[model samples]
Target: MEFDLDYLVQQLPALRAGLLLTMQVSAIAILLSVVVGLLGASARVLRLPLLSPLIAAYVEFIRNTPLLVQLFFIFFGLPSFGLTLSLFWSGVLALTLWAGAFQVENVRGGLAAVSPGLGEAARALGLTRWQYLRLVGLPLAVRSGLPAMLNTGVSLVKNSAYVSAIGLQDLAGVAFDRIASDFRAFEMLAVLLVGYLALVLSLSAAVRLLEHRLQAPFRR
Candidate 1:
């Protein structure tokens, strides 16, 4: 079979639109997941009574279940409970919660690595728990956990493809649609691989830059 350069060129507009949609969805989800990770990790580490145990249960549930099931439950099942969300928001919410669970553990591990002496010193210096976490502990924890956090971020971008299962016209969805109509499986699949690779590499590069900056103060 011949590679169809002209066919791909003709489909560029649709493909680009799909890629942009994926990027938009992934961006929103990544940002929200990071917020969830940090807050959840902080609460658990501080042992915030009811809230901490609830976060632990949430993390376990999300990590154990398949993402596709979660996606379906959000997109198809939630309407039964009168909590309907648009397709885009549903995808965003599912991805955010899924990735956020792993991130919570990743961040919690980093927080655990914080020296016990530091917490003691913080108290002796009259720094309240929240203040110490804000001013010192969280910064150090984030630096230690940056790699795992970014790994979850990269996975989040790739997993954005799952939104296509619900008929969201993201990159994978567009490829499947074009293949169904045009019968260009080779071309469409090839394009899908390239699009996802581009997204992952872009995210990895950004993560590396962030890691370097975060490590700078301790590089001496």
Candidate 2:
């Protein structure tokens, strides 16, 4: 088989478009995941009456199952109950829920790591539960979990490729189409690999920078 560098170059435009779509979907899903993680973590930490168990079950189920199955359920199964979503929204929703599950545990672990003395001190200081969480708990949990959050972000970006399985025009989807047209499997797959690597590396760098900034005060 011949390596066709020129053929890969010719497909750059489509691949670039696909990359942009992947980034857009990933950005939205990551944001949603963070929100879900924070809320779920808080519920578990506080032991909210009924909500905690539900969140726990959700986290367990999502973490245990394959994301592809979740995506298919969202895109295909929901229509059976008359709940339908567009392909892009379906991908985004599935990714958000899936990532959120792992993130919840990351945050919960961070919350658990908080020293018992701190909570006691907050109570002794007459800090309400809400204030204690906002002023003390949340910051500490986020700081301790920053690395895990970064890992989740990177995972989310890579997993966005799976959206291609549902006919979303993401990087993987576009590459598959191009490969089908030109029959340049090696070249297209190589480009796909490189594209995801660049994305993950860039995201990891940005997260590391943010982590450094967050740690600045502690260094002093």
Candidate 3:
């Protein structure tokens, strides 16, 4: 089958819209997930009496379950319980919860690296536990866990394709829709691969740059 450059070019507007929506959803989810990670990690690290075990359970459950199942539950199942979200918010919530689980582990691992001496010192200096965590622990932990967090961001971006299942017109959804009508599997697939590759690579480059800046303080 001949590759239709003209057809691909003609589809650029739809592809562009899809790409924008994908990026928007990913950005919101990634940002929110990081917040969830920080809070969840802090709770677990501090061993909060009531919250820590529940957070641990949440992390484990989200990590263990399939994201698609989670997505379906949020988008489809929730309506049965009298709670319904718009497709965009539903996608964002699903991705945030899924990535937030991994981010919690990543940030917790970073928090675990904090020296016991520091905690003792904070206590000696009369810093409240919350103050110590916010002023010292989280800053250091976030810096340490940044790479892993960024990796989760990348995965979330790729996983955004799954949002299409809920009828969101993200990149993959647009491509699938076009192929179904035009029967141009080769063209659509090829463009889809390239679009994802470019998006991931761009994200990776940004991650590296951010890492470099964050680690600069530790450099000789």
- Best candidate according to TM-score: 1
Candidate 2 residues 15-59, lDDT tens each? 889999999999999999999999999888888999999999999
lDDT of 3 by residue, 1-220 (tens): 9999999999999999999999999999999999999999989987999999999999999999999999999999999999999999999999999999999999998888888899999999999989999998898888888888888998999899999998999999999999999999999999888888888899899988988998898899
Residue pairs in collision within model 3: none
lDDT of each: 0.94, 0.93, 0.93
User: Total clashing residue pairs per candidate?
Assistant: 0, 0, 0
RMSD of each: 0.9, 1.1, 1.1
Model 1: which residue pairs collide? none
Full-model lDDT, candidate 1: 0.94
- Candidate 2: clashing pairs of residues: none
Off by over 4 Å in 3: none
TM-score of each: 0.97, 0.97, 0.96
